[model samples]
Target: MAKVTFKGNPITLLGNEVKVGDQAPNFTVLANDLSPVTLENSEGTTRIISVVPSLDTGVCDQQTRRFNEEAAHLEGVTILTISVDLPFAQKRWCGAAGIDKVQTLSDHRDLSFGEAYGVVIKELRLLARAVFVIDKNNKITYVEYVSEATNHPNYDAAIEAAKKA
Candidate 1:
């Protein structure tokens, strides 16, 4: 597992650590309307999955908005921001932020995405900061597990990986 810290305090992460070249794990996360969405549903397109602890925080908000802005310029790429926040909150944040390019999904119900991606913060019941890029064939091309929960990811590297995919 990747070592993580939040505000200078160490935290435990539960789940297998995912790395580049591994097959992306399939998991069910809820859409804004509480409908189930899984990795199997987006098989043909290159995907960038942005995992954050919550959307209401400063870092998480900026991370999602950054991807949302970049999504507008990237053709044939699907960007998803996953968080433990409720579906209602995710929807509201997206609307208030004017984030139309990226789809914000909630992992509150089951933490399937959190476990599958190895991002769940054991102490807080939240997802640690991370980013993943999966190719059209479902193989992971890039993985970024931010060392600190309150930090940002390598947006350029993740975006470049998706472009190459």
Candidate 2:
């Protein structure tokens, strides 16, 4: 498992750690409408799966917004932000933030996505900050598990990987 910390304190992350060239794991998450969304739903396009602990926090909000802004320029790439935040909160945040390019998914109900991605922070029941770039064939092409839960990910690297994918 990748080492991670929250606010400088160590925390345990649960599940398998994914790597580049591996088949992207399929996990169910809830869309804004509370509908189930899985990895297969966007199989034909490249994807940037942005994982954050919560959208209510500063770093997470900026991370999602950065990806949302980049989504407009990355044609054929689908950007999805997954967080344990409830769908209602995600929807409300997106609306208030005017975030349209990136789709926000909720992983609060079951932590399916979090567990599959090996980003579930056990101590807090939130996901560690990370980013994944998967190709059109559903093969993961890039993976970044940020060392600190509250820090931002490598936006340029993630975006570049998505473009190449």
The residue-by-residue lDDT of candidate 1 on 1-165, one tens digit each, is 888899999999988789999999999999999999999878899999999999999999999999999998899999999999999999999999999999998999999999998999999999999999999999999999999888899999999999999
Cα TM-score per model: 0.98, 0.99
In angstroms, how far off is 73's CA in candidate 1? 1.2
Q: Model 2 segments beyond 4 Å from truth?
A: none
For each candidate, the alpha-carbon lDDT, in order, equals 0.93, 0.94
lDDT for residue 52 in candidate 1, whole number 0-100: 91
Instruction: Enumerate residue pairs that collide in model 2.
Output: none
Q: Which stretches of candidate 1 lie over 4 Å from their true place?
A: none
What would the per-residue lDDT of candidate 2 be over residues 40-126, giving only the tens digit for each residue? 999899999999988999999899899998988999999999999999999999999999999999999999998998999998899
